[model samples]
Target: MQLDDLRQNWETFGAENPMWAIYTGRGRIEWDEGEFFATGDTEISEVMAVLERHGAPSGAARALDFGCGLGRLSQALAAHYETVDGVDISEPMIEGAKALARQPTGVDESRLRYHLNTKADLSIFEDESFDLVFSLITLQHMRPEFSRSYIAEFCRLVRPGGVVFFQLPTHRTTALKRLRGAAGRTMRKVRRSLLGGEPVMEMYGTPRKDVEALLTTGGLRVLDVLPDELAGPSWQSFRYLAIRPDSGD
Candidate 1:
């Protein structure tokens, strides 16, 4: 789908969709019984492992999940942090997230709240309000220039020595996939357009060096870059963990 059309659909369906089911699916609301992406337990486990590897704070840590569609990862984070906020640009997504909080998940729903807004501009939050900030499969939707500002904002919102985790696809592997066959090539083009172009977005793919530079330049220290293999079958995607440097550092 074209970027403009996708945005329009999100805006329209965001406010009108009952159950806000479209926010969790591929595009707009197309529900599949027991086949919801947001219900997967592996997502939560992966996120938790990423956080744990990066030394995420426990007991009184404040965390924020950017682009938290339906609050799946946010719900997981709530288990370790004292306070957790999930932010998304879609209102329907937020609604779905809120509804999930009432479920019997053995989690402290009191510590979870969903915010409807863009991560590029988090003015509603005070500076340095969170100890950890994390996002998954979301940054690709932003243009590169905008992504720089978004990362800057994430760094600004996190307290000194805090951690930030993000997962993104790379261009090289994507290009390779395109070369493999017609189906792969077609999917590649579609994904590139859905996500923004390179440098701001991870359309085709991005080199490890470029990704590290972007993170470091945005005032974060690259702590680890777990390659595709480490993430099992999802090796085409990469996970990044970085830390907000102390003021003096």
Candidate 2:
């Protein structure tokens, strides 16, 4: 999808059902405020534990949560890092995140902040700005070209000795499944052009070898690749863990 179309699609999803768009398991029903954030806490905790075991994220100073829907992961990262930036392609998502952060039970404004970036790369931040560059299910929504650029940007955005972590599907398991995926894409395109209704959610993936090459080309050292079920049973997915060498930083 084009950048404009991606932003527009997320904007509609953000406005209509922000929580469910972030985590479809929540259903279209209203999400319990505490429960929603608690999941974030659990996820971030698990991520940190795994990274720590690998001696990643040389510092705990700052973190960047890309495609941070409503600042769920951003807020969770704040407990570990000194500062956290939550960035999304949708204005409504950023506004909703800011609103949630301002709540009494929400995170401290000084610790967590949100930004709306509709571009293909994260150039707004300086090089090596964050100690941890994190993304979860966010990258799967956009086209691979966009995702590839962001993966490279992650390498630049993270500090020397810091970690870059993300999850993405590799490919469909079977040829039939791949054909069906392509057909679904065509159908979605037709529906959008002809009907002009709500934006449909899209899924994309990168080959495992390409992802490794991207990280290496971006100067990151691959730490591990763990099989993940985040993309569901049909699609083959993996969580990437890589870190930048200190280089005497």
Candidate 3:
């Protein structure tokens, strides 16, 4: 869909429906002031673990949460980073995020901000301004051509030793899984319907090799590619971590 159409769709969706509750799985009729949806606790915990394993810098690392829906992870990042900026393509998502940031919580509200835009073009933010950049279930939605640019932007936003991470559904694995079971087939049908005979920028299927190639071509070094359900049965997804090569590392 065109950017304007996508924006209008989200705006209408947000205006008529509470985006926060819908996107976060917080229930249709109720909203949870203390919990986050869209991304589950298990995924958040895994992200934190990966960040910690890589060694978060001491005392407030400037961080960026790309595709930060409803500011759930953005709010969490604020607690650890000196400043946390949440960026999303959907204006309603950013609106809900901004609202969440304003609530009186133990987190330092002064350190959080929201931007509405795509990751492929983050012209609003200066280069090398962040210590860490991350996104969850957001990259897969970007068009393949734009995905390359988004990875480049992620690299540009982080300082020379800064880390960047993102998750994408693996096309090959997902397809194989779909062929194995009724539930998987149902999921495949749902996904195909969502595409609706037109290229949905967000529904772009990215394979693991393609994503790794993009990162490598973008001048970032791969640190890891953790399988989504290494320990149990779950959707096939991959999380990638990479760092910008310093002048001399």
Steric overlap count per candidate:
8, 0, 3
TM-score between model 1 and native:
0.71
Local lDDT at 235 for model 2? 88
Score residue 62 of candidate 3 by CA lDDT: 90
Question: 220, model 3: CA deviation in Å?
Answer: 1.3
Q: lDDT of all predictions, in order shown?
A: 0.66, 0.89, 0.68
Once model 3 is optimally superposed onto the true structure by TM-score, how far is the C-alpha of residue 189 displaced, in angstroms? 14
Model 2, range 1-249, lDDT digits (tens) per residue?
898998999999999988988887444477887788888999889898889899875344899999998988888888888889999999999999999988776878988888899888898899999889999999888899999999999999988888899999999888999999999999999989998866878888899999999999999999999998778667899999998889974
Lowest-scoring 10 consecutive residues by lDDT in candidate 2? 25-34
Residue 66 CA displacement from its true place in model 3, Å: 0.8
Model 1 RMSD vs true structure: 6.1
| C-alpha lDDT of candidate 2 relative to the true structure | 0.89
Tens-digit lDDT track of model 1 for 51-89: 676676656888889878677678777767898899887
Worst 10 residues of 3 by lDDT: 196-205
Best by TM-score, which number? 2
Ranking 1 against 3 by lDDT, winner: 3
* TM-scores of all candidate predictions against the true structure: 0.71, 0.95, 0.77
**What is the C-alpha lDDT profile of model 3 across 1-249, one tens digit per residue?**
445544554555555554442353333455565644434444566677887887745246898988787777777766667888888877777887787667775356678888888434888899888888888766655456666677778877888888888877665445555455445445655775687432222344567888888778777889889876321233467788988778898
- The C-alpha stretches of model 3 lying farther than 4 A from their native spots are 18-30, 37-43, 56-58, 118-120, 172-202, 229-235
Best-to-worst ranking by lDDT? 2, 3, 1
Worst 10 residues of 1 by lDDT: 196-205
